[model samples]
Target: MDGSQGRKTRQVVAAIAAGGKVGRQKDLLACGHSEWSLRQAVKAGMIMRIAPGYYALPDADPLDLHLARHQARKTCFSKAAELGLWILNPVPQPHVAAAHGRPVPGCKVHRVKGGQTLMDILRQCVGCGSELEALAVLESAVVLKQCTVHELRTAFSRRGDGAARAVIAMIDPQSQSIVETAARYLLKKVGYNVQGQASVWGVGHLDLLVEGILGVELDGEKYHNTPEGWAEDLRRDNLLVINGVWKLRIPAAVVLYNPDLMLLWVERALDRIETASPR
Candidate 1:
C-alpha cells in the first residue's frame, strides 16, 4: 500500500476501534472500506476477525471480544464496573445482556437487547443485585456525572419499578466514594440522619455528618497513605477538636468489612459526647 492508502487504512482502523474497539462487517463497509480492503487489512494484521461477522483491532479487550462473540453487551455489575462505577460486591462471572435470553457460556445473562444505555445497566443492576448494591452504583453514576438523579428517577418511573425508584431516591452525589456511600447507608438504616459532604467552620468538608454534630471522615488508603496526607489529616483533626466538633476518622476497610464494629464505636462516641454536654 502507498502512503495515501496506508493513511486511509489507519483511519478505517481508528474508526473501528472508536466503536468499542470492534465493528461488524457491515459497519466496516458503511465506513467506506471495501471488502477487498478489509481482507487486505485482516491479512496485513491490522484487525482480526473474531467471529464470523465481527471484526476487532488486533489487541481488543478480551471482554469486548467475548461480548462480540456472544452477540451480547455487558450488563448488571459487569457493565457498572466497565463504566468505572462503584460495585459493593463484584460477581465472579461476567454479566451480560442478550436478546431472547440467549445463553452465553460462563456469563450471567439478562434477557434484554441493546443494553447500551445507562438506564438499562442500572435496571439490570437493580434486578440482579441487592438494594445496597444498586444504591452504590447509582450514587457512583451521580458522582461521575454520567447521569442525573432526576433522569434516573424518570427512567425508573414505569410500573413495577417502585423498588428501583426508591433506591434512586437514596442517591447522594456528594458521597465521594463507595466506602462513604456504604457507611452513610448503614448509619441511615440504623436511624441516624446522616448528611453527606458536610462542611465545618474550620475543617472544610467532611465525608459525612451524623445528626448535625458528629463529623465522620471515611479514610481510603489511597488518599491517606502518603506523609503529606497524614499531616493534612492531623491538621484537620486538631482543627475539629479546637472547634468543639465531635469527629470520627474511620478507615474505608473498617466500614466495608466490620460495619457493626464501626457503628458500635460511633454509638460509644455519641454516648460520651452526650454525657459531657453542658445542660
Candidate 2:
C-alpha cells in the first residue's frame, strides 16, 4: 500500500480501539514492512482512513467510537504493558490512548478521566475500575449518577455507538435495586418513589423497584459465561417466583446496544400486573 492510504487505515483502527493505540512502527517492523504501507491501504480504501498509520477495521463504525483517540501520541509506560504490576495500576489518566502525530498542545489527555458514575457499582469497586468506568462520568456527567435506570437509559440511547453502549453498561434494570439510593437525589425530580433492594425467603436481594410494583435486574453476563452459572440463574429464577418478586433481567448487551428491548419487556411485565387488577 502507498504511504497515505496505509496511514489512514492505521488511523481508523486506532480510532475504533479508543483509549487504545496501535503502533505503526512496531506493526510494520514486525511484518518486515515499513509503516508507509498502512498509508497505502488507507488510500486504496482497503482499510479505514485514520490519522496517519493507524487502522480501524473496515467495517468498524467510526461514528460509534471517538475519532480523537487516533490523534494522541502513545506512551510506553502504560500499565498493561508492565511485566508484573498488580492492582491493575488504577486507570491511566483520562485513559486516553496515544496516536501517531504531532501531539495536540494544551489538550489535557488523561486516561479514563470520566466515563461512569459511582452508582453502577453495587458497592465501591475493589482495587480500581476500568478506563470505561471513568469515561462514564466524563461522557454523561455527575448528574447522570443521579438519575434512575429508566431516566438514564433514556439519556444513554442518544449517544453515539460505542459511547451509548458504554453508558448503558453502567446502569441496567438493576436500577430497581438501587433506585431508592438514586431517588434520594435524582429520582425525586421525576416524582417516582424509589424502593431499595428487597429480600425474599428464597430469592436474594433484588436490584430496585418503584411503588413495590416493578422489579429490575441488571445482568453483566459474567454468570452466563459458565454452565454452572446458567444453571444457577434458572434456580434463582424459581426462587424469585417463590418469593413473589417477578424480575425483568436486563443483559448488558441489551441494556447497552438494544435497550429498547429492555423497555419493551418492562412495559409488558407492567402491563400484566395492570391487567390482573380490577380497575
Candidate 2 C-alpha lDDT tens digits along 1-279: 567655555654554344333334444445554455555655666555454544555565433133343454312122222212112123434222332333434332333322223332211121134433333332233323444545545544543435444544443333231222222223223454545465656666665564477676666556566898788778878887777766777765565556456657766887887797677
lDDT per model vs. reference: 0.88, 0.45
For candidate 2, the TM-score is 0.37
Instruction: List clash counts for every candidate, in order.
Output: 0, 55
* Strongest candidate by TM-score: 1
Q: Estimate each model's TM-score.
A: 0.93, 0.37
Which pairs, if any, clash in model 1? none
Q: After superposition, how far is residue 201 of candidate 1 from its true place, in Å?
A: 0.9
RMSD of each: 1.9, 14.4
Flag regions of model 1 displaced more than 4 Å. Answer: 26-36
Candidate 1, 126-242: lDDT as tens digits: 988888999999989999999999899889989999999889889997888999999999999999999999988778998999988898999988989999999999999999999
Name the 10 consecutive residues with the lowest summed lDDT in model 1. Answer: 108-117
